[model samples]
Target: MRRSRLTVVGNAVALPLLLAVLWWVASADSESIYFPSLQKILGAFPETWLDDGWGSSIIVDGVPSVARLAIGFASAALIAVALGTAIGLHPRLRAFVEPILELVRAIPGPVLVPVVSLFAGIGDGMKVAVITLGALWPILLNTIDGVRGVDPVMTETARSYHLSRPRRLIALVLPAASPQIFAGMRQGLSVGIILMVISEMFAATNGLGFSVVQFQRNFALPEMWTGIIVLGTLGLLASLVLQFAETRVLRWYTGLRAADHES
Candidate 1:
């Protein structure tokens, strides 16, 4: 436990130190790459983010982008989990759908942006559709894997208890499958965030991506850098929160793993 905790702390320290060194190195050649100094970039963040009422713009753009992502992701989750559970329980359905799913997943998400835009017209609908397309497959595939991976003994025990179909699924399958579902969700979230930004960059009038593009085109390098940094920070925070939640929710699974190691 102590070693694991130290490892986490070490990584936390090392990553920032590495980033600092990289920032310094990159900025040293500022004359060539036109890179901003670390301090200058940090200093400009507040003005770019808050001054000129970019705060309002960010809120307007960011809120809509996030709302689209959330709506799309939630819809995808429900559909994926339901379809995945059905496919998992039925071998024929799994075989029938797996290839189609694989094909969809294989297609690059960015490629669909144009098609979605064409159909949906650079609107929130298009953005949500693309985000859903990008996020759904991982969750569906993971759900199938998780449900199928549940121990036979557990299923047998549930059946022996005369559990109803809904009760069995709710009490047994879901709990057994949660870890993999969460894993899928993590993957979906990563893809979803990327898609959200890409969709915004391609068409939106306001958003982090739009702001970055606006700054770049206007030669506001400091602001562009600030936008990039803020986006990175947002991704980092989202991933950390998800990971922490996953750990808390799967404590029993983690404890079981630890016990097995001890034995």
Candidate 2:
């Protein structure tokens, strides 16, 4: 168990450690104007983000972007799960809307930036709207698939027990479909982050995206690198959080899978 725990820790840090070493070696003696040394970037981190204390530029710039991501993602997940459930339960509805969904999904999310900006203007509302529309498809489709994939036997059992509609959905359907729903949510989050950054790049005043662009245009290479690093860190942290949540929520599933494997 101790060895296994150590192995897990080693595996978790191995890639990051290697990348850090590589970055340090590659850029240690670099003189290029566009590509600052990793040390310089690290040095610039405090100056750019923490110079003004806790409520510094980083917090000011990052919070809105995070908030937008959270709100947009939450809205997408809720709407997608609800709508997907409805469509999954109704074959006619799924048949009627599947083609339309495919057509819309084919249009890349970033492409909607200009179109959404026109109607919503360059505001937080527009940013959130863009994120929502962009991220909605994955969750919606995944939820639909998840719901449809639920065991017919389990569903029939619920019906046989004369479970009320709400009780059946709550006690049986949602739990069965949760894994898929989470999978969709995970995909949506990555897409949402991308869209959030893209939305801010076009007409936004403040965000990590704006900061990165601003730094690049101003030739602040270290600050640009910092923003890029921060974005990567955010993505990593968000994914880890989602994974932790998934493990907790799907504990029973995990146990069942383990038992099956053991058997």
Candidate 3:
């Protein structure tokens, strides 16, 4: 157990450590106007993002971005899971809606940014809408697939016991389909982050994305790099949090898989 824990820790830190070393070495003496040294970017970070009292750029920019992402992703996940359950359990409904779902999914998410902006205007509403719509597809489709993939035997057993629809879904179907649902959620999360940035790029007063663009336009390369680094850090943290949640949520599934392998 100790060895396993150590391995996990090492795996988590190895890549970041290596990348930090590489970045430090490679950009140590960089003179290019476009590519500032990592040190310079790090130095600029405090000044640009952290120095202002309660109104620091990081708080102003990062907080709203994170809030929009949370609201959008949460709304998307809840709606997708509920709707997918309905569609997945009904063959006729699935067949009727499949084509339209595919067509809508085919339209690249970012392409909707301008249209959403036009209708919703550039506000929190537009940003959240863009993110929710963009990230909805993966979770929705994966949930449908997961629900459909549940074993027929399990469904029969639930029916034999006279389980209510909601009870069956909660106790049987959801547990069985959780892994796939989680996979979809992770994909949706990544998509949400990308859309969050993209949505803010066009008509936004404050956000990491807006700040990045502002820095670039002003030729503040180091500050721009800081924004990029912040985005990367946010993505990594979000992924780690999701992974931990998934492990907890699917612990029973994981235990069963392990038992099967042992047997």
Candidate 4:
């Protein structure tokens, strides 16, 4: 534990130092290049915030992005888990659907951006659909892996005990499958964040992505840098939160391993 903590602290220290060096290198030649310095970007943040009406209209800008992400990711999760579970639990269903899944997963998410934009016309719905489509593959694929990987012993035990279908799923399968489910969720989340920004950048009038494009087009280099930094920070923060949640929720499985190691 102490070693792990030290390793974490080391990485935390190292990352900032590396970033600072990169920032300095970029700043020195910033006049010739499109890159802005860390300091300049930091300085621009408040002004950008103010100009965007962060006090009153932050919601107008931010809410749309957040709401779209939430809706799209939730929809993706529901459909992916449902369909993946069905496929995983039944060999026949897998045989029927795997080909279709393979084809859909083969297509890049951004390729659909034009199609979505054409039909939906830069609306929130289009953005949400893009996010959902982009995120669905990872979740669905991971879920299929998880469900199929559930312990056969547990399944047999449930059957021997005459467990009902719902009971078997809830008691015997879900707990066993939770780790994989969480893994899928993590993949989905990362992909969803990417698609969210992409959709906004290409299609929406208001979002962090839009903010980046707006600043870049206006040649506000510092503000553009600030937006990019914020987007990266948001993605990092969100991933971190999900990781923490996963740790908390899967304490039992993790703790069991820890206990075994101690023994």
Give the alpha-carbon lDDT of every model: 0.81, 0.87, 0.90, 0.79
Q: What lDDT tens digits, residue by residue, belong to model 1 across residues 1-263?
A: 56764685576558867997889777864653247787778788767776654542456655676688788778778888998888997899999888888888898878888999998998888989988888888999999999999899999999999999899898888778989998998999888888888888886877777788888887888778888887777777666667777777888888999999999
Which candidate has the top score in TM-score? 3
Point out the worst 10-residue segment of candidate 1 by lDDT.
52-61
Pairs that clash in candidate 2: none
Of the two candidates 2 and 3, the one with more favorable lDDT, higher being better, is: 3
Model 1 pairs whose backbones collide: none
Off by over 4 Å in 2: 1-14, 52-56
TM-score for each predicted model, relative to the true structure = 0.88, 0.93, 0.95, 0.87
Between 2 and 4, whose lDDT is larger? 2
Which regions of candidate 3 are displaced past 4 Å? 1-10, 53-56
Query: What is candidate 4's lDDT per residue for 1-263, written digit by digit as tens?
Result: 46754675576457767887887777865654476567677777776765653331345556777788789988998888888888889999998989999999989888878898898888888899998988889889988888899988889988999999999887767677778888888888888888888888884678887877877788877877777777776776666667667777778999898999999
Give the TM-score ranking, best first.
3, 2, 1, 4
Residue-level lDDT of model 2, residues 1-263, one tens digit each, is 46754675577568877998899999999999889899998988998877843233767888898999999988988899999999988999999999999999899999989999899999999999989988899999998998899899998999999999999899988899999999999989999999999998987788989888988888888888989988987887677778767877988888899899999
Worst window of 10 by summed lDDT in candidate 4: 52-61
Error of 2 at 234 (Å): 0.8
Error of 2 at 158 (Å): 0.9
